[model samples]
Target: MTRGLVEDEKKEEETEKKAKKAAPAKPRKKATKKPAPKKRPDLEAHPTPEKEEKAPPKTEKSAETPPKIEKKPEEKPLEYKNDIVEVSVYHKPGCRIEMQIKASQDMVKEAHKKAIRTVSKQVNFPGFRKGKAPPEMILKNHPRDVDKSWQQVIADVAFKEAQSLAKVSLLD
Candidate 1:
């Protein structure tokens, strides 16, 4: 029985080896790349000239006819006016405008008073409630704040007045 088992194992091994040898190998395909596209000629850079045919000469009647005249409509200039701030607007090319503004002396004085009041409201002073401090004290202590407030007030008023006069919407 042991000899019969050994002989069967040897026969299986021999069959596997013969099967491997009998199988043929398949051929492999080569990898290929697509061709590049051709470039188009630049006609604008080097334009080709073609022969143009000459037109028949104009008749005497066609030459005697007067050319038509076209009339253009008149355009009105833009106008701007303001009481507090004087605005001079210059219309430039490409739909743009330039403005020069000058605030009146009265406007400046009013702006200064308003700025002092605004600063006094925001800051507290000794023996005084918030927003009830004297303008003199606020001016003496917070000159820089007063100046900034004054400029802001003047700019706001001038911009609003200028926008209305010019009839143009402005961004803040």
Candidate 2:
């Protein structure tokens, strides 16, 4: 019985080795070329020649001349400050808070300024003194920081309002 068991084990090991050898190795995938992009119609070839000709020309200006920067009109703040934040709370097995914040341009601008000031204090930018640079310039240097700050401010405001508006404890 012992001899028969030893022979069976040896046969199983041989079979496994044979099976591995019989199986073919997977071939690597060849890189395929992407299709060329479609050509767009030229502006000069468009049918609206009269509209293009009517536009004013600054063709004589040198390459070094800075482009005219147009200041966007500032949006007026909401008449009712209370209406700025609308919070919705769902009370079920688990509490869910949903908030829609309507921020005027002025509010966003203020948040950006605050974020810029905070970032500038921590980080040193070239050519400008620390925390003394313009808000717009500082914002350009640390866009992610400004965005995060604004989002944090908005979320804090929303959560505070939601808690009061819902009147139900969210943690419970």
| Cα lDDT, model 1, residue 67 | 68
For candidate 1, write residues 1-172 as lDDT tens digits.
9999999999999999999899887778889888896766753477569889898799997789976778665344455655687787767668777777788898999999999999998998889999998888999999999999999999998877887888776556
Best by TM-score: 1
The reply for model 1, stretches above 4 Å from the true place, is 1-79
What is residue 73's positional error in candidate 2, in angstroms? 46
Residue pairs with colliding backbones in model 1 are: none
Task: Give candidate 2 misplaced runs (Cα > 4 Å).
Answer: 1-81, 94-107, 127-129, 168-172
Looking at model 1, residue 91 earns an lDDT score of 70
Question: lDDT of all the models against the reference?
Answer: 0.84, 0.65
Residue 64's lDDT within candidate 2 is 64
lDDT of 2 by residue, 1-172 (tens): 9999999999999999999999998999999999997677663465754554565655767456888899866444222234444443332333443434455565556666676677778778788888887787767777888788777766665556545654546563
Best lDDT goes to which candidate?
A: 1
